[model samples]
Target chain A: MTRSGLRGLRAAALTGTLVLASGAFAAENPIKLGVLEDQSGDFAAATIGKVHAIQLAAEEINKAGGIMGRPLELVTYDTQSDNTRYQEFMRRVLQRDKVDVVFAGFSSASREAYRPIVDQFNGFAFYNNQYEGGVCDGHMVVTGAVPEQQFSTLIPYMMQTYGKKVYTLAADYNFGQISAEWVRKIVKENGGEMAGEEFIPLGVSQFSQSIQNIQKAKPDFVVTLLVGTAQASYYEQAASANVNLPMASSVNVGQGYEHKRFKPPSLKDMYVTTNYIEEIDTPKSKEFLAKFKAKFPNEPYVNQEAENSYLALYLYKQMVERAKSTNRDEIRKVIAMGDVCMEAPEGKVCIDPKSQHMSHTIYLAKVGADHSISFPKVWEDIKPYWLGEAGCDLTKKDPMAQYTPSNPPPKP
Target chain B: MDIATLAFSALYQFGDAFAFLVLSACGLAVIFGMMGVINLAHGEFIMCGAYVTAATVHAGLPLPLGILCGTLASAFVGVLVELLVIRHLYERPLDTIVATWGLSLIATQGTLILVGSTMAGVGTPFGSFQVGAYSYSIYRIVLFVAALAVLAALYALFNWTRFGVLARATIQVPHMAAALGVDTRLIYSLTFACGAGLAGLAGGLYAPTMTLVPTMGATFIMEAFVTVVIGGADVFLGTAPAGGILAIVKSGMTSWQGQLFGQIGLLIAVIIVVRVLPKGISGFVLRERT
Candidate 1:
């Protein structure tokens, strides 16, 4: 070989080694946490706080020397509250951004839209919104309170405080339908008769007839599973129409913070069961709120979903630290060990290793006439029992399918 | 419940449904029905009205005054939209649909950017009155009366006024009306503005009963479009009758079955009406009279 050619070859070899060394160095860099949230559109009002909460969690983690000396970096994308956007953005964050972990989805539709994409990429995700439960995916961790945690506490209290006859107004969708089934099951189990039930389509704002029907039924209390901006108006319409029956809901005052949005007496005499609301007056929650407000002062209310999102990141950090690695399989094994828990703003929240859902401390909140929230009851350490009973054990099986009450597990 | 109470309940339901249908459709009746312009952004115009009303009310204005401001604000926006966008698309019906749809998207997103996602809602006023087992919103009754008053006002303005004749002439035969010294352009702009104002009025009226959001306008668009299509081209002859029949079908189905069946029945009714009378209720009534 010529002398010049040999020098060129030597330089190329040095360049290759430098590139490999830099690549190896990059692995020890900040861990990328993908946050795909509905920053705009209909669900934005409800889910925007979640993005803030995640940011706050990341800031705190980075301040405390992020998971094993690697700083936490957020790769955020606004899904615009559209399912198609959720899919598109989920793919973008998972593939192009090469994020280590993704925390995405507000609605069940949004979650289901991108869930398959997450599975296809063999990526890990966290869905931290309250839903109808029964999602048995090994690739995902759901920190939200499920039907077993919410309805189990809410229904009996409602039935006992009011009467046995209950009227249910649910949104017309998978979440609503499945949640309604849980309500029916719980109501029946508590020996309460359902006076009436109606599934309202998402955009049906007119509730005069529904109110009139409820009055005619004369139920002791009303159970509302209404979701979204339009369905939320039922409170105003019902209040205006003087449908004086007390209302019990698992979704309303907690997720949307409707008590803060609506005028007084609209949400009056309403009972809501949730894991967290800004009204939660615990020392830890107060400290969390103080930090949150100090960070994002313009935020109206710290909703239940935000707390879930905030804690999920800390939970992820804990899992990553315990596993001592960022590998998806190692983290999954750590999660399956059933010991991952966090001192969340909502209290002691633990990951149920078998179901991959959170065990929450559910609070029964009542809305006063002035729209003030009061927690009259608390159910501590409510396990997501429904999925466990439905035979969801992520360690033994990876169904990658959601189970509903009607669709039970196949025979062993 | 006794038969008397049941009868009152049925009547109340029908009235409420009728009021909702009529109010939702009234503005679209003028814009789409009379003007032959397919305004897909009709809902956003309503949103403007609601937003203005809610914002103004929260700013400590009286409710009625706030509603007036809302109506005027929407009307002014309508005029701007007409001058800038709608004027050019007057001869192009299909293009207007696309343009207005684009405008709706812009308006919804723009509102979101400006005011954020939502504002605190205005409380429904007028309290309630009990009939038997059911207590009804007096505000609902007020809405029913307001719907009638709006329809009656529209009927009078278009039928008994000089501007109404000129508007009809301009829309029906624009060149002829222009040649005969009527300002066809002015008539068109004014009529469009009126339609938008009426839509704003609907928004203002219903703002108190709804949770206000940028997308809240969509909740009204379906009913509005349905009512306008069924009402046909003649606002005076078609809108009220169409609203009445639809109200009966919707309320009756809702009362008998539930909301889902009620919606299904409404769609079915729309299908039957369109299939049987392609020109709509007004067209049929006009044909029979002629």
Candidate 2:
């Protein structure tokens, strides 16, 4: 059969089912949610957890009779960590499958690739991953911690507690570059000095010379924005070289869950700022974790990305119920109205009316000697400040643009 | 930094980077230079070694024994690959490339299914010592010595042993050596095993400083192929000199600028060498007297 003919047949069958369901079930059809996740590729390690967490949320929601008297049907497609696949599947989800909402994208690159399709089709997407953020799109709701939310609290605490001189190592990419700029801004804001900084390519794992360079600079602490499994070599190499300058990262720990992946003492004394870790002892987190564990008993520990997915689904549910409809336009209007909040496993999280991003709590934690993470202090309700700095009022919907630091700090 | 400290640091950096390039490329150079077959699964062979070493160590073996086990395991797999797939494609370069590339994909995905995407690696042995104002890893120094030792061992074996002589003669003149009662095919398999064993050793040694992932081989494969091509067909002399020059240039550039520029320097160095000396550094070094 011809490809378009097959699609036509599927489309006709889908409409027929919708008509029958609407006629028999209170004139309401099932609300379809699209899930595009990286299940078996480079981003799989971090994103697979999010996929499971979303599934758990959908299962729980359905058990409670769903929203608006319609069962939630999740249509999932594994992107296989390919950006081209993301674009293809996004088009199908937004146009052919016609899902009301999309909970997708793991990396910043993938998110950018799919964003235009969502805009062109007037589809709503919820990006549920922490990143170096400055996205202000009316059609998308970003539920991840931006650099300002993560670093504004982390840098000061690190500099004051550790020392005033910092050495920064970042992956030579947009996320790392922007996050490194934020490090400089936050360091300067807190009266700290950048002793040295260097950007390594993403796949260069040899760190011997880099370590020697760090040792010579003699920084109070080393701040890293390195990404990927290759960059994780820094932890072991640094430990072996005894360049023990009390390291921390704006990236790492929770994202890859490196603490669990690497042996102890390598990550000991390292600090990372995150929204959630499985070790949070709060009653709300404990209950949610227990429920998650009960559902998937053998699954590895949950990280912030998984918790973000779990939280974003509930927020989507809340908005859908609040609008009393699953229509994309109506749901988008309800989101623009703002004031929707959820008591997430981390803390109380709400949508910032101006930026269309999440305002949530951030925690500063240390990787313990036993490879478990523990929070030393919690910064409550940090808003996404970069969008506000750029005057990105998404409710006004002036521009669907990303804001980045224009004047990056000069190298030390 | 003081001049003395600076010079010592530069030398140490050179040694570390030189050892890295030499270790990663030596195995592939041997296989390609000696056997005349392009082993596209060279990286997968290294991955196999690393995974086996990590898995063995995790299963409660001593670190040294685990490393040895990794080498032996990779050698066994190499022999199996030879008997099954590689033998049929001998002297057929393009076919060998395709077959070996298919083998690499199968190895990677199969391991991903059976083992996992990521596995914990053993801790780096030894610690660090202060060098002037800077500190250097002792394991990196160990790596430097190990690379030179492997090169010298290969040289001595090829020059002094009866098996090495027979293997060299077989590669140089298969028909003549076979007519003279040498088991030419067996020599080929043995040489291939030796190359794979070297790769296994490199991977086992490097496992401690890496995150053991199924796709970790891709990180090492590019530099390996580059060094081998720039080294030409003379396995010992070519591989060593080319790898050293590339490593020194890369390490110096990394210290002067950053890792990005350092990698760019290495690639530019390779292009310049390939363009200027088509026979590679060894061919140039081993030129006949006029």
Please write out the lDDT profile of model 2 over residues A342-371, one tens digit for every residue: 899999999987777999889897987777
**Over 4 Å off in model 1, which ranges?**
A1-29
Model 1 C-alpha lDDT per residue in residues B156-177, reported as the tens digit of each score: 9988999998999999999999
Local distance difference test, each candidate: 0.91, 0.85
True contacts kept of each: 0.78, 0.77
Candidate DockQ values, in order, are 0.75, 0.71
Q: Model 1, residue B85: displacement in angstroms?
A: 1.0
Error of 2 at B48 (Å): 1.4
Best by TM-score: 1
Docking class of 1: medium
Q: Determine which window of 10 residues in candidate 2 chain A has minimal summed lDDT.
A: A403-412
lDDT value for candidate 1? Answer: 0.91
